[model samples]
Target chain A: MTTITQGHAAQDHAHDSHGPARGLSRWLFTTNHKDIGTLYLLFALVMLFVGGGMALVIRAELFQPGLQFVNPEFFNQMTTMHALIMVFGMIMPAFVGFANWMIPMMIGAPDMALPRLNNWSFWILPFAGTILLSTLFMDGGGPAAGWTLYPPLVLQSGNSLAFAIFAVHLLGMSSILGAINIIVTVMNMRAPGMTLLKMPMFVWTWLITAYLLILVMPVLAGGVTMLLTDRFFGTSFFQAAGGGDPVLFQHIFWFFGHPEVYIIILPSFGIISQIIPTFSRKPLFGYSSMVYATAGIAFLSCIVWAHHMFTVGMPLAGQMFFMMSTMLIAIPTAVKVFNWTATMWRGSLSFETPMLFAIAFLFLFSIGGFSGVMMAIAPVDFQYHDTYFIVAHFHYVLVPGALFAAIGGAYFWLPKWTGHMYDETLGKIHFWLSAVGVNLTFFPQHFLGLAGMPRRIPDYATQFADWNAVSSVGAFLFGFSQLMFVYIVVKCIRGGKQATAQVWDNPEGLEWTVPSPAPYHTFDEAPLIK
Target chain B: MTTRQDIDPELQRRIRRNALMVGGFALLIFVLYIVAVALKVAG
Candidate 1:
């Protein structure tokens, strides 16, 4: 691997061709993958704070005996929009950002396969999100019918519904385009020697995720379009009166939504796969199996959408089949979990911030997954469905699971992205605070849900007060803990200790071969795969 | 990078197969929806 110092000639080369366009046009016209990646990441970070603030409001409203903070209708809107924003606006975009920035580097390509289309895909997001968020302040209310947008109830929702349906179309459109870009880049633009199996885990995960995005995003777009027409254009695509079954709407939505959950979490698995190996000073265990399991899970995702709607009065045999199919996902997911542990077994393990989050992810995510399996049981889901237990289960899965892995990934790759090391003391503090805050926030909701507290209500029955108080306190702590994340990320970007080309001691991959704070355009020259 | 012919033929074939399968599945879903709607009308 050749490392070129930024001599005057390279600096001259850099400034000469890539002329300054001041602020707006640089982001608009430039097709640089890193620039687009930065756009995605920055968008996600801003939206994270937005979503996080919504959670606090939800918690604050639920903190006491009566509706203290907001009305029940407004509270419902917050939960609905919060879920939508975090899933599509924040988590998905962050992972896509990682893909844009790192896939080419890992695969030895200089830029995304369709760079102009990439810019177009990203630029659609802000406008789409604006349209959706705008619904909150308009007449009746936002799409308060929950993120699922189950028909009948969703049908009677406020005037904001059409805007949300269109907004979802725009979001899904962006995702599909972004996924296609990743797919083409992976398939067509790898360096000379990097084979499919030999590509980095992050690239592999994004490859599968891109496939998931393409297949299901259009299904989602079609479903919402039907909803739009059903509501306004006098079509009966989802209305029973028009010969459209409500259950069929579910079938279409879950066909999209179930895979959408995987869309949220798959890249986290890839991040953990990469980080576990690097921090443990071991090659990823069952690397081949990891790839197979990821693909296996993706394949299974399409078949298991019906599991989410187990209560819709399908045939008993159908229920049994969906229940069993959902359970089958456990096999591949367990493979990933066990492999991460095996990779960490007795190697030169150090508790860096990244590794700390990875370890927390294993325990917390597994707890969430175990509960998830319980929820998969048709009878058990009858008890737990639409309860705070369900909320606890997914927040656990998403917060520590996907979101923690994201922070870990950000910490792990920070040195590579910036030419400096973040403060270890601060990083570790942020991780610990986040872990504590995560547990504080999510654990009590389990009791509330199991105690028969239903979700989305601004006011709870008196029986639910104690656990609700505990949960509220946890929410406040969790919200504040994220401020530390914002600080550390900013501090690192400004300046810190100069990082080595290989930031971690045992890290392996093409990314380490580049200089720290990877050059503006990387993977330009293909490295011969050893 | 050299053209696809220069690399392993097996890998290229596998790539082509994966692409075809994914594309075929998408097309199948598209066709299934059309059939479902048609059946709803005719039945």
Candidate 2:
């Protein structure tokens, strides 16, 4: 036994002596969590541009309406591709990137419990994304039935249908594997004194999010796979001609879809939770309650899937159940909003870029949340369903809600990642532009929708024309402003003011204990979390 | 010089076991979904 132990110890020592490998091979083959984290972040960044370019196509076409740029088919393709790429390719992976970089460190684990699985999880994404994007070039332009891929219409989508389904399967598999790794690492690998309750909010949020992923991703896979078979294998799961119900597809899709929204937002909640307290220079107010609120949100997310399908003509009972459950989600979400406010109340607050973004997320996400409550009224939804009002509502949630939190997270941690401070002036400029651009882009759509303009169209009535034009201009400004964010990140990485290990003034976490630009490998020995 | 083997063996076993359980649970849900769909088609 002693001999075997010595041999294992020697192997570990040798492993520790090496740093990252040279060149592209390092990223391609690395099992290091930090390397994988960097790969996920970079990949998400590239996809953001790819996805954003698609948004620009959408906005430019909508600039003056009347099909100014692409055909209607292509316009539908842009909206479809934009949502798929942003949700799966950009936002999900970006949060996963943060998890990879921060989770083990926060919990004081040596590395992910399943390091090889982490590498596989990230590598699967690019190939999956490639398959999905390549569909746009297929004989029939991409999956144009919106990201929902509602059947019958989706069934008619050209050769891209099978490829897109396969891509969804791959994406689902990747998420499941990543989720498993996170659960195992958090459950089994926390440093000795880091009890579950004692974990940082980011780690707790991710733990819950991972469980959400494991539960919901498989359902999406099954739904898409059923779609694949219906298209090619003579199955009629959603084909009305064969007595299969079309509404059933909506049921299945939203069962996965609604939780997927929380999957996207919950991590942002975690990020904001971390930022608000830090800027406030206070221990997180209501830390335990914050954790419970997150769990409450996740639980509520599962029951509220039917809320998205209110227009599908469910029985009044079903609609009432879904509406009430969705409204209940507001209780926990409001608790969170209140906690963040309380954390900042009269504490010597400073508005660094991260805090600025978090503050924007607070007010704007509330706007989104209030709009969501408006839609949750089953009676109100009949009027608002599928209108640009719905469009405005979610963009408020996602752009400022999820996307801003993500950008804020990046700012919060960029100094640690690069060992250099990003240009503060440029970050604030980026923030203002993004804030202004987002409101200008989506806020007008509310007016247009109320005026009876439907979504996913290439042209609009002249009465709706004014808001659409303003929205288009806002989209351009928002699109161009993101370029500055890219520049800020790149500039910080290349060179800037040096950062200390703490990065911020006495932030509370094990991560702050490590050197800035956190070494290639960390926590080889598990930290005792006293 | 700590290698994977240097970590506490019992903890390692627990991690591996729990990971498999989670992975298995996800796969089970996927399989069950497909089975339900198949049953519906047959019916």
Candidate 3:
């Protein structure tokens, strides 16, 4: 076994050998995967606030439900921009950022397979984000048609429409490039003996995610571009009078959209798989099955896009096909959840921040998953469609599901990334606030949806008052608590107790074999794996 | 004393090929968009 002294000494030697490039140009011109990864992550953290700020505006507007702070149009703009920013800007990029940082290290690679392209991918994002955010300040306000960018409604959005489409194109291009980088790195760059099955779960999930991104991102680009032409070029692809079908747009968008949901969460599955085993001090219960389950979910994600369109007047046959396909996803997803629980069962489990968040993810994401199955029932969906319950369902999936894994991942690797220990007490505080705050915010919305409160409205009837108020308070608590998260990240990066090479005791991967704050360049000579 | 600057030629070839393929696929998306616009929808 490698001793702690040896770990610390090796880290010191690495630091002396390869000090980082100095100044802003280092960031601008650097193709080092670690530097680029840091850039992607920092950008995403900033956007989390930018998007979260927009959500707070939305929650505050819905606080009293009587046109309190902003007009209905502006309220619509807030909701629209919020979802676009959070999905395209925050969650998706955050996972990609993690992929960039972790994938090369986890595999025994010196750098990403395409280092220059990796730099290009990270750079495009900030520009795309700028264009999207700039729309809010434009004359007609941001694309108020909602993030779904549904036709006729989105077509009605003024100059902002073109900008939104262009932004989507840029974001899609960035993801596609990042996906290619990941695919090439994993496929070609592994050490000689690190066979496919011997690779880490994180690498496996990302390889699958990269495939999903390449397949679907262009479809989204195509759909949004069609919307652009329909609005600006006098093409009527969505106009009923001009031989265009509005329903056709929905089909195209959701084709990319539903798989887009899995694209975000699949990496989280990898992250959870890694964290659970370490804390449980056990090998993952079913490594091969976990991989198969991910592939199965990706396959199911493709056929089940039509579930989102159940209310759009498809034929009975169409609705039944979609409904059954959607339900089938629960099977593979259950295998994943069961595998995680079994990994934790009766092992030496500890509730450090990462494990706590992972455990929370299992329960809360399941709540989202369960509610999703409820929506899959075509007959019952008619009652629940477009209600706060639908909002509640997805938030449970995204916030605790994707975001929890993201936060846990950061905590899991922060020591390695910064080469220092973060304040454990503060990390726990952030997790509890987020856990309780997220539950408080979305749990009551389920009741409100059942109580017949529709979403995306600026005002509501007096009857839905209590839950809306409770949810708003929770939103503020959740939003502000993230500041604590930012503080923890910054404080750790600056300095703290020096970390050992294996920051955690039992993470079995190439990443832990490297020193904390890994060398600017690593694995020049690949380490041997049995 | 091989430094990080010396990348493998075989790796270089693979990276070049993959980059071109991704570029080609991106071009195909634009082609699909044009087809989407030109094709007349069924009433």
| Candidate 2: Cα lDDT at A134 | 96
Which of the CAPRI classes, incorrect, acceptable, medium or high, describes model 1? incorrect
Per-residue lDDT over A428-510 for candidate 2, one digit per residue giving the tens place of the 0 to 100 score: 99999999999999999899888889999988877887888899899999989999999999999999999998899878887
Backbone clashes in model 2, listed as residue pairs? A13-B1
lDDT, candidate 2, equals 0.89
The RMSD (Cα, Å) of candidate 3 is 2.7
Looking at model 3, residue A178 earns an lDDT score of 91
Q: Each candidate's lDDT (Cα)? A: 0.84, 0.89, 0.87
Decoy 3 TM-score against native:
0.96
- DockQ scores for all predicted structures: 0.14, 0.54, 0.43
Question: How do the predictions measure up, each by TM-score?
Answer: 0.92, 0.96, 0.96
- The number of the candidate with the highest lDDT is 2
Error of 1 at A53 (Å): 0.9
Candidate 3 wrongly placed segments (more than 4 Å):
A1-18, B1-3, B33-43
Q: List ranges where model 1 is wrong by over 4 Å.
A: A1-21, B2-43
Tally clashes: model 3. 0
Tens digits of per-residue lDDT, candidate 3, A185-249, equal 88878766678888888889999998888888888888887788888998887887788889988
Per DockQ, what order, best first?
A: 2, 3, 1
Model 1, span A1-530: residue lDDT tens: 21222211211233234433578989987788888888999899999999999999998888787979788889989999999999989999999888988887787776776788899999999999899899999898899989989887899887789999988988887887788778877997777667888887888889999899878887777677777777888877778887777787789889989888889889999899889888899888888899999999999999988888887888999889989999999999999999999999998998899999999999999999999899999988988978999999999999999999889999999898888999999999988888888898899899999998998889989999888888889888878888888898899999999998889894888778777888876643445664
Where is model 2 more than 4 Å wrong at Cα? A1-15, B1-5
